[model samples]
Target chain A: MKIKNILKGAVFGVFAVSGAAHAADVTLNALFMAQAAYSEDDIRNMTADFKAANPGVDVNVELVPYEALHDKIVLSQSANGYDVVLYDVIWPAEFAQYKLLDDVTDRIDDKTRKAVLSGAWTTVEYDGKYYGMPWIADTKFLFYNKDMLKKAGFDHPPATWEELETQAKAIKDKGIVDYPLVWSWSQSEAAICDYTTILSGMGGQFLDADGKPAFNTGGGLKALQYMVGTINDGVTNPNSREYAEEDVRRVFSSGQAAFALNWGYMYNLANDPAESQVAGNVGIVPAPGEAGVSKASAVNGSMGLGIPTKSTHKEEAWKYIQFLTSQKVQNKYAKLSLPVWEASYSNPDVIKGQEPFVNAAKTSFAVMAPRPTMASYQEASAVLQEALQNAMLGTATPTDALNNAAKTIADLQ
Target chain B: MISYRKTVTAWLLLTPMIVIILGVSGYPLIKTVYYSLTGAKLIAPDLTDAWIGFGNYIRALSSSNFREAIWHTTYFAVISVGVEMIIGVMVALLLNEVFVGRTLLRAMLILPLALPTVVNAMMWRLIYNPDFGALNALLVQLGMLDAYRSWLGDPATALDMVIVADVWKNFPLVALIALAALQTVPKDLYEAATLDGAGMWNRFWRITLPAILGPLSVALVLRTIEAFKVFDIIYVMTRGGPASSTKTVSFYVYQEAFAYMRVGSGASYALIVVLISACLIAGYMYLIRKHGEA
Candidate 1:
């Protein structure tokens, strides 16, 4: 009887030990934007790779629409559900102020610092502390329809806003198209980006060194006047006031517009025969300047990969971030999203695939200025978008519009 | 002693409902009121949550945007509900009569009412698109105009365009209510009027109108409250743009709380809206009660 009792106790001990070990394995939930930057299959594959390397961890990714991602992140932070969040570049300062992100300042070593684009680092750092891993490095590109330009008797894309208008007028007169330009001028975040590109190219800064609104200056008015002038002159689509980026891309991709302004990802989609009527005929260049004031300056449109402060699996999340941002993984996914790694810009394979986009990015990077990085960025952006829309629609002149925006921004600050 | 026991039993019976109401509605209301007195933010701590003692209220009162939003909300509610009532009663009267395909026509009439608000808004947005939209295409095809029109893009027409869309989506509800009220009007009353040598218009004014007035008033009050708090359609369509022409009070609160993240200001704004809604409801109830008594 004693021997049988001992044997039973030993078997029970063995079962309990294994069960405890199984329960100790960690599972993480990640929130990502449902954008074209990464395909579901690619995300799944990357997670599978992570799982194989670390067998004790399981990851579940939830895809959210771009518009809903911010709200979802905030809700999940309060509920303590999401372990990792893919955040926009403009959100870090605000999120950091809320203490919603884990400080990964120490995690980002000197090697990682040297590897990424210098501009990308500016996005994820707040108050001298790093909050995220630089994942995407993005900028806007000037996309033109080569066929439309050739039909309009132009061999090259316009280098200046004046040249663009001249070409647009010629195209309209020649009956090539009713509107030679299409813009994403809707009152959304994209409007701020487009306006920033134009504003910076005309040597205008959104704010002075003291962070007061300086967009009411001469250069700012000129930029606004030029953009609204194109529409008034019937060179750009009249419906541009209602268009978002995708709407503008559609017009250009359908062979209806001579020029458009869109992000780097549109290059692939616009060249794909399945999606575009102007396949193999799309030409990319720097956005136009005001002829002599400055060169075309692209606005930075990057996002960061960050671990939420409420995450219990912070160590595991860091591991995931490291794996996701490694040179090999970023290189493998370069076609879907541009790599943050500086070295990848010179990779022969990357050069072969995205030469035009990379070349424009190079010029844009040298002259790029970041969006207003403030905790009240959303308010500032809304104010600017409304002002730009008013200017474009002739509800208010550029001077009046900027003055109103300045007052609002001053109050918000 | 027996009465006291019965009172205890009654209180016990009502306990669950009271608890549920407190949990679902009372708590949020209390929280909103509390936040309104403090400087709070949706995402970040605002000024350490210390009481500001009507600071937010003063700001809201001083802001020109808030005044404009109030004007917009009132304008939208009055015009939309007024137009909807007239059209709804007429449609209800038309549909109340027996016809060959009465059942199918009744079903088709209520289809718009069955659609989700967001879906209806999106459908209208597509229809109102300046380029290749159905409205422009149909108008041009019918030779109503020579060129395509930016119906929603133009500020002069933006709010009215939204009102039209809202009417199309919402009139069916008012019609359904009116139709129900119309059913209650006695056929004997109409027959008596006809025997008295009364014409169609007289019968409508004397019998049909009075019979449906109470129910139509109820429908009006309900839709008026809803129209005053309109946000989803505006968000999906104009985003309160063309120079803030359609910025309703509810949209202003939404922008404050979610977009600008100023929870304190937003909460104060919401309480103000609720007060307005309460006054409107109270006045409507008094008028209806007086009419009923008369």
Candidate 2:
């Protein structure tokens, strides 16, 4: 009888402990990239803030290299590897199509939805549902060396493609720089991005309203012609074809190029006296468009935060997302990235040191175009990059290259 | 009856290895074959269990990109392997002779082989950089040209430049193999040839050449197989750029699978390549067997 009573007491104790453990607070895992714009300390501080605001929740953040994040997401889709996922702009539509992301339409409040920039909001929308929240709003701007422009006797940045060529030639003729323009035209994702800026400025479309390949239209040929003409006219470096975006920024920062087209982040990096030779001699402006063709020159590029569809801690993840994207938190985020919240634009802290970006963004945002949203965007962009490379290298005429790419894309579909 | 029992016991002893080989290699091969006949994507719900027999194979075979890639891959393999073999033999011959610091020279020669292929590719990319690369800087300093030429940006030179990088990374392996073979060659043969009043050319042609052919053929086959599947260097340095001049079969397969996310087509493309490779390897084995008999 004593042994039986002892067993009954032990069983009661085990059940009581399990019940207590089940009542503990929830924890959520987040996967993000350790890019130049978002550091580990930023995530750590944000997690701390979120934890303080919600005493019953804990957050775990896993940061990976930018190059590995895409493959990681693709591999982790089935397992819902993380409760929250940070992804590039190109990913929302594709991830949503594969049912890898949660439909957070109801979770986002109307006021919060209306607070983000329209261009950034569009990146997170697909098939009439929202899959993510925009975290950073990015777009390219024309960066020029003020000393080189002054040496060439130009008081302002070029406003048109014709004027750009003329100014570049003047700078080249004066021997201010061997190449007046340096571009990120390497045949990879960067090349396609650079091409999109030119294509949009020339009023060309990558896909028509019917969603067919339309980049080989008249405007497309003209854009390619202008790009290749720069090399033929001795205004841009022949080495441009081999350079990625960082390489172009490196050239401009070293006071070697009269002009460069890069993302807004380049402004801060190029002005640091320790890293740049022409720290204070830099001017930022809108990228030039062809005369009477287009006023829009830049493309919208950004990353978003989302919850995976299979996550079990949806409530906790949503709470953390709201805390991280709040105006106060985004205001702090602006130090490392452009603010996604439109109201943060007028924040004195945001505009204090980044006047050029703020001013340029006002115009750029109004005209920013996005790359085509497709499940197979990687393949599509690759075809476009190859076509541009073929035309630039003189291996194929612009018409032939684009036409071939059109056929290939049709096959891919 | 006793012999039959012995054979059964032997088969039972080999069961674990057979099961392991089937589980590791055979399972994946069969799954790949099955997937090639189905409509599959690399990610998510699109990776379904639907049958579309031979459709992916037909589409890939008819694609222009695949055709161009086949030609480029073949050309790259032939050129890179041929050049690597010739240079490897010459280097091996030179290193085999008694000289000052022979051991140091031997170690230095294999350094490129020891370095990772990805690192070698990146180093070559820096060297080929037109604006600030060592190649252009050195050429300009030597007054060889008035301007820096874009080596990788031009279509005509991109493939050749990639080939040079591949050769630099792989030729050392072939040289090391030839060096090992050279040590096996008897010194008395050279002495015998010299006593017979044979010239240096005759001595080398009659003795060294024949003695090395056995190992040289093995090296050639190995290098050829490796060159045909070249991907990392191409992926890094050129990415088959300047007009798809360097896109090898493996790179094409990778683009289809990961970039295009078309697992079905990628599997079909891979199977076709495997078929071709199997035939080539069979021929190589036949040649090796024939050489051994000779």
Candidate 3:
């Protein structure tokens, strides 16, 4: 009888532990990129805060490089994949087509929609439906060395693309820097971002009314020509053909380049004395536009956090995303990436040390151009990346390269 | 009846391994072949509706980019494996001799081979950095180079640079294999060859060469298959950049399936790679059979 009693007690103990686990504990897995925008530590701390507020809910975060982020998200879909994934602005069409992300249109309310910046909505919106919440409101900005400019006899930063080139030439002639300009023109999405900035500034369209390739002529042709011209004139760094965004930042921060085209995250890092050699000499401005086209240029390089369709703990995952994108959380960690909420721009804490960044962002966010939104955007981008590299490497003329890319992308459609 | 019982027990003991092998590799291989014939989307729920036989193969064969990738893979495989074999045998012959610190040198040879390919690739990337790399610094300081130049960034030198890194990490493996084969060669053979008035080159060409050829060929076939499927090193080092100059067949398949989300076409490309690897494997089996007969 005593042995039977002990056995009954053991069975009851196992039941009690498992019963408690099934009731309240929900662990959500989130996938995030390690580069740019929000730092990994900030995401972890924010997730920790969310967990503290909601007892028995935990978030396991995994970070990957931006180049590997897309593949990881897709590969994990067939399995019990990530509950939450951070997606690039260019991926919504592809993700929605494949049903990789859950449609959260009903979860997002009008109040939240109105609070966030209008441009940020584009990051998660596809086919008039919302797939996720925009967390990173970003665009490329022109970073210049004020000391180099001053030494080259310039009082103000360039206001147009031609003026920027003239200043770069002046800087180069004055021996301020061997390569006055550095760009992320490597054969990747980064090169596309830079190309889009110039193309948008020159008033180019990626597609026509019938969704045909339109980037081969007019302003698109001019943009590629200008890129090739800089390289040919010995003003742009030759090594930039292998550079990505981080490389551009490194070259700029080391005082090797007088001017660079990079994202908003570089503004703070480039200004921090601990991280940059040319800290105090860094200056920020919107990317210059063409003489007759526009005032400034930018590309829609934002990212969003979404729940994948295969996630089991989606309710808890959505809660975590909401908390992370909440105004309070975003404002607290606004050093690296600015918040998507429009009201946070007026918040003194957000603007205290980043006044120039905020000022440039105000202009840039309005004019940020979107890359072509299609299900085959990745393939299209690859073709364009090669074309850009071909032109930059002098293997083909800019016109020929752009035409070939247009033909290939047209076939992809 | 006793022998029959023993055979039954043996079959029972091997059942788990057979099941495991079929589950892990056999199932995936069959599924890949099935997917290659169908027009399946990677993320789609239903895969039964889209079947287009031989279409993906034709498309892959027609693409210039895929053809270029095949050429690149061929070039990488031939050069890296050929160089590795030559260097490996030389190192093995040298180490086979009576020398001081032979044990220490053998241990050191394992270092590069033991390092993970990703780590090796990353180290080589840093070493090849155009602006501040150790290579450029050394070359400039030695008065061999006029200035710092991009090594992996230029299309003309990127693939060759990657080959150099691959050889560095993998030649040690071949050396170790060759060294083991060399030890089994009888001391009497070299003594006999020298007694017959053979020179160092002749002895190496006749006795040493034949003794190590069997193991060396095995290493050659294995390295050839591996070098043809090179992805991680290229992925980490240059990402097929400066105009896709270093893209191999594996990288092409990865992009087609994962990046582009065309599962059906990607499967076809992957099967083509497998077919090529299978051919090499068949050649390996034939060589081994011939060696056994000899």
Candidate of highest DockQ? 3
Q: What is the lDDT of residue A286 in candidate 3?
A: 95
Tens digit of per-residue lDDT, candidate 3, span A37-65: 88888889998899999998988899998
CA error at residue A393 for candidate 1, angstroms: 1.0
DockQ scores for all predicted structures = 0.42, 0.45, 0.83
lDDT of model 1 at residue B161? Answer: 88
Q: lDDT by residue for model 1 over A1-413, one digit each (tens)?
A: 99999999999999998888769888889998766466677788888998899989999989876656776777676689988889887888888888989999988889889889888888798888999998877777789888888988899999887898999999999999988888888777777778888888888888889999888886777788888899899998988877776788788888888888877777878888998999899998888876668778677778889999999999999999889888888888776677888898899877776788778877876677688788888878878888988888888998999999998999889
Candidate 3 residue spans exceeding 4 A from truth: A1-22, B1-12, B45-49, B291-294
Candidate 2 residues A48-104, lDDT tens each?
A: 988998987878889985545766777676566888888877777678777888899
Report lDDT (Cα) of residue B47, candidate 1. 51
Q: RMSD of each candidate?
A: 5.1, 5.1, 2.8
Least accurate 10 contiguous residues by lDDT in model 1 chain B: B41-50
Model 3 per-residue lDDT at A92: 96
TM-score of each candidate's B chain against the true B chain? 0.96, 0.92, 0.95
For model 3, give the TM-score of chain B.
0.95
What docking grade applies to model 2?
Answer: acceptable
Worst-scoring 10-residue span by lDDT in model 2 chain A: A65-74
